[model samples]
Target chain A: MAEPVLSIRDLRKSFGALKATDGVSLDLRPGEIHALIGPNGAGKTTLIHQIAGGITPDSGEVVFLGEDIGALGVAARARRGLGRSFQISSLAPEFSALRNVMLAVQSRQGSSFRFFRPVMKDRSLTEPAMAMLERTGLAARANVPAAELSHGERRQLEIAIALALGPRAFLLDEPMAGMGPEGSRALTAFLDGLRHEAPILLVEHDMDAVFALADRISVLVYGRVIATGTVDEVRGDAEVRRAYLGERP
Target chain B: MSRERAINLLLAGLLLSVPLAALALGELFYITLATRMAILALAAVGLNFALGLGGLVSFGHAAFFGIGGYVAGIFSSHAFNQTPLFSWPFEFFGSDQMPAIWLAAMLISALIALPIGAISLRTAGVYFIMITLAFAQMIYYFAISWPAYGGEDGLSIVVRNGFPGVNTAVPLIFFLVCYVLLLAALALFALVRDSRFGAALQAGRQNETRLAAVGIAPFRIRLAAFTISAAITGLAGALLADLNRFVSPSMLSWQMSGELIVLIILGGTGRLFGPVAGAMLFVLFEFVLGGLTERWQFFLGLILLGVVLFARGGLIGVLAGKARHG
Candidate 1:
């Protein structure tokens, strides 16, 4: 197999007395959807935070595209093609969906420092942002402020923003977190399509969506990965079933 | 351009021509007062960088503004007396040249803001407001107690500091200097507002987590903006000192900070000319009201409180309404 696009080894982080992440390890390859699933408070979000360059791990190395990016900041990491979506919808609520995506595009294109030239007239940046919105099925909602968007549309807009950054990989934290059944099904299909474009590390709670779209799944329990495999392998694994699936039953 | 932007431009042009008209009418003192308005507006322009775009709401900007004034005053005083400020190893040098003083003022304010911003940035909401206010009070006390440069009494510039090719004492020429700087400041504000760094700054204010998700560090962005904002305000302080030929502890007081905020709120925060309009209105109100009543400031404070409590948008906001698009 080709070299893994992202590798996390023995990652650990603690908050006060709580060990949020304990020896978490995973690897993601190009063009694959890797879903991380766990019970509440399992440190899935913490692990994602460390990987996305938001929080520094107390121990372990995060190697992305052959670089040990422990010291780089969030924007520097993004400049290197690491994009993240928040578990809680995190768009500029007052900004129109189009402008929100356009900002991400603006950061990647050139210095957003051109001031004398009017921003609204800057087609060089806005055109691509609009196109990305079109790709994400948000063309109809482009003019609406993000705050006005339905929860499902905001999730789609979040994905569109990540896409506009032209990321090499996506770290999406609960993209379908607050969506209804219809929203979840629609998002799962959209994410399934994205698997062909870039490797995605999806942290999600929707079991049905995870089972439907993930190329591979890692079950995290108490900050440690108990299993990483295809649907059949993970579903059949006794440890994952006992630790997570058993509770569902 | 849109009809709205075109109208905004026309208003700016009309405002710009006022001091020139004052000069033509031979109202020299009024010209000087207009110069004062521009300089104060320039300080608000700096505050705009932090308050308007970055949403920092710094109440300590008066500290930087006062520091800039004191730097000019101390330098000119030492130059006039022809003595080293202190008997340090290298000796503290002094210059009466306004550019030299202004540059030094900018450097000092930026350096000071680094520490102030680092500490204040740790907290958000009301905590940020209190911390900034506390820092400004600390500076104000220091200035009041120092007793150097006359402290509460203020230091005066015996002669107006020299500017190249201009009679710096002449009201029209001085007003021109202030006008040019105000425009330069407005241009910088317009540029920074549209820049990528500006985008990240505003985003940081809107939703810090979202900014972090996009790989932008809110702290660093805020720090850069804070330092630049302080530097701009410091430049204004130096100009103010030159205009009045005085630097007093009052410049560092909390009241000055409140007035700066009032200027932005009155003009409309975030708009380029908001501070300018606020400054003009403030000066006009002070002049006109002071002429009409003995207790004008009481009325002015009442009006300002009304604006803050009742007015969602300042003058510009009321005039321009909402921005239709980005």
Candidate 2:
């Protein structure tokens, strides 16, 4: 009922012959987790890349907060509240988990051109960064570098960094890609609660987590949305069952 | 005390006391040698800001260095001749004032860095390195062909430039001046390294995509760092020209840039005191080896090869352990 926080319309991208993303359109409104479910090479990540301003679409419009943002670069889009998380866990590897989150906090605070004052002593940056780390269950490992963080902790740190941006919507690509069963369950619960703070356009392969958390489901097959509906409606869709669900149905 | 803190204190003490001791013993040549170390250390300190922290391997920093030297040489020459630098718009007479010349050098270097960094930061990897080197070569050739300022023969100052409250013509006084500037620049470097901007710059170096995703433009941060880096280098260049009473195309040569980088790596890249240690070692090698043989650079090359191949962290890393964050 409310205006969508993010709207992607008629997005198309191609690599020579293969149509990576072909006329894909989606919208994420406030207070909902819109799960994008697909098999391998289904163009889920490419579509996320387009929406997050990582890659330019051959033809499309990405509207954020009712403004066309197709021309903005990744940093500009981020400053406008388009938060992104990578499937491969992109982070400052040498920086401590706290410093990594503090970067996000500093970004959210406005111009980071302040040069004389020591950032480590700045409570304004550190306190909120610590809070975010605590929220993601990374408080204990705050001083450890991201390179040394456990796989699950790195994923949690990514979420904490995204949260620090005060994003209007989350473009999370495979947030649970490397997680164990327990980590997945915990993150699923965490993400389900996070949807109340901001809408999430979650691209994931973890069907169990997707089923438990998605307020609405969209099945992407070969770069096209084959079906969009409640879990039961999408689960019963014949094309999705044949193309994606397969024998599991 | 921590080994790093101990080494830091020892370095400060040695740098300060050695020159003062030379002054006490009337070893004027040693004072000059100490002054050379301080000046060269200051130059590498400027390079360290970009190469060490920002991870910008600038191969043309000698362009700024030469610019600073030229600023000092040109201004003092005009002042000595009692000629206005230009007749149009106003009588712009040159100044022998050290502070004014340093300001001019820094401003000019920063201005040059703005355009150079804007174009260079667009690229990364070897392209960035080659482009920067190419820009420095352009300046070097320009200086060579510009006959008004002595061309390839270079410009020389008739006397050392003036600094307030100090007879900069005195060898010991000049060494003290250089020493004080080196310490001030080191303090500034430490402060900048710990700032929020420094955090963003380092993060940009580590993972640019992550930096961009967090809403900080890597290009802007790097451009700022490069500009500041050049300004510091340029100031050191002016002081160096004053020390030698000359400015030449040799200062703009690519070898100077390589030597600056050598000092950084030889000390420890990204470590605060790395340049100081490297400069001391380099000058000492030049002195001792030069005394022993004519082919000293050949031996110096051997030592540099050993450091590169075997001792990855350089003299400071071996002596002081790992850098605090590193």
Candidate 3:
């Protein structure tokens, strides 16, 4: 019933002939996990990109924090409190985990133009960065570079980075991709608690995590949302079962 | 201690000691050669801020270097001639003072870098490299065609600029002045490398999209790095002109830009001591090889080829171990 923190309306994108995202509309409210699941090449990532300002929608509006952010760039949107993570694990591989998180913390604090003081020695930056790392269970690996982190740890670090941004809403694109069962379970529990802090527009293929964590689910098929409902309602929907949840439901 | 730290300390020691040894041994010419290495190292250090850290491979840095040289040439020329640079506004007099000239050089170079970096940072990869090179060439050709300051023949100063309490005209004193400045620039480089700005700049270099996701604009960070880098390189250029008592369009040439990059690559791209090591090696090769034969550059080319093909990390990697970052 709360006003949506992020609202995407009639978002459309095309690559020559194929409409990657056609007339897609979605809303993410506070304290809710809105999972967007679809089969391969269903334009889930394209829709997420439009919302995160990575791609310009042919005709649509992405309203964030009561402002039409369709014209903003990725950094501008991020500064305005929209957090995102890549399915392919986008991180500064050369930087230590703590430093990577510290970058996000620095962005939140104030201007990063302060050049004279050594960031490594600054307790204000390091303490908050360490706290984020601790929250992600990567406290011990804080000194390790992102490139040296395990796949699971890198995913966790991504969440830690996003959390440091103090985002009003999170547009997480497949955060649990390439994780094992144990990692997925752990991350699912973490996401369950994370939803209380900010709503998540999760685009994931891991149905177990999605079914367990999503307060509401939206089935995207061929650049369109075929169904949006609770776990039981979406499970019983014939179109979702035929198009996506086929034999499982 | 780590091998990298050990090698870095050894390099600092060698650069400092060798010059002092030359001065003590009355090898005045060797002092001059050492001074050349310091000045060249300083220039490469400036480029390293943008190229190594920010991943901005600027091929037009010679514009900053030449601008610094011209500042020295123009200011000292006016002072020597007892002529006001201009009487229209408020009668601006020229200065032979090193501090004033260094300030002018840095300010002018930063001003130039602002517009150039603003335009160049809009592109990335090879396009960024070519656009910066093209801008440098524009400045180079401009300096050549404009005949007021001697054009292709270049401007020459009768005496080197003055430094407070130091007889800069003396070879040893002048070398000392340059050495001190090089050390200061090296300190600045180290400070920036560990700063928050440096973190964002390096992150931008590694993954621009990720940097943007964290709410830091890659273009702004890179432009700041580029402008600061140009200012440092410009200061080195002024020192170089003062050392030679000459300034020419050649200082602005594309070859000069290539040489600056060579110094960084030959040493180690992102390593702190990389520029110093590369500059020393380069000057030593030029001196030793030139004494042997006129076609010494052919052998230098061969050595550079070997380093590029076999030792991708340059002399620093071979001696100091792997760079902190790939």
Which number leads on DockQ? 2
lDDT tens digits, residues B1-326, model 3? 87987887888778777768987898878988988999999999999999988989999999999999999999999999998989987887789999999999999999999999999999999999999999999999999998978899999988899999989988878877888888888889888888889988999989999999989988889999999999999999999999989999999999999999988989988878889999999999999999999998899889889999999888988987765631
* Fnat of each prediction, in sequence: 0.45, 0.80, 0.77
Clashing pairs in 2: none
| Stretches of model 2 off by over 4 angstroms after superposition | none
Model 3 off-target regions past 4 Å? A247-249
Candidate 2 lDDT, tens digit per residue, B35-125? 9999999999999999989999999999999999999999999999999999898997889999999999999999999999999999999
Q: Can you give the lDDT of residue A17 in candidate 3?
A: 96
Question: So what's the TM-score on candidate 1?
Answer: 0.88
The C-alpha lDDT values of all candidates are: 0.86, 0.92, 0.91
| Better candidate number, 1 or 3, judged by DockQ | 3
The alpha-carbon lDDT assigned to residue A22 of candidate 2 equals 85
Docking category for candidate 2?
medium
* Residue B227 alpha-carbon offset, candidate 2, angstroms: 0.3
lDDT of 1 at B112: 96
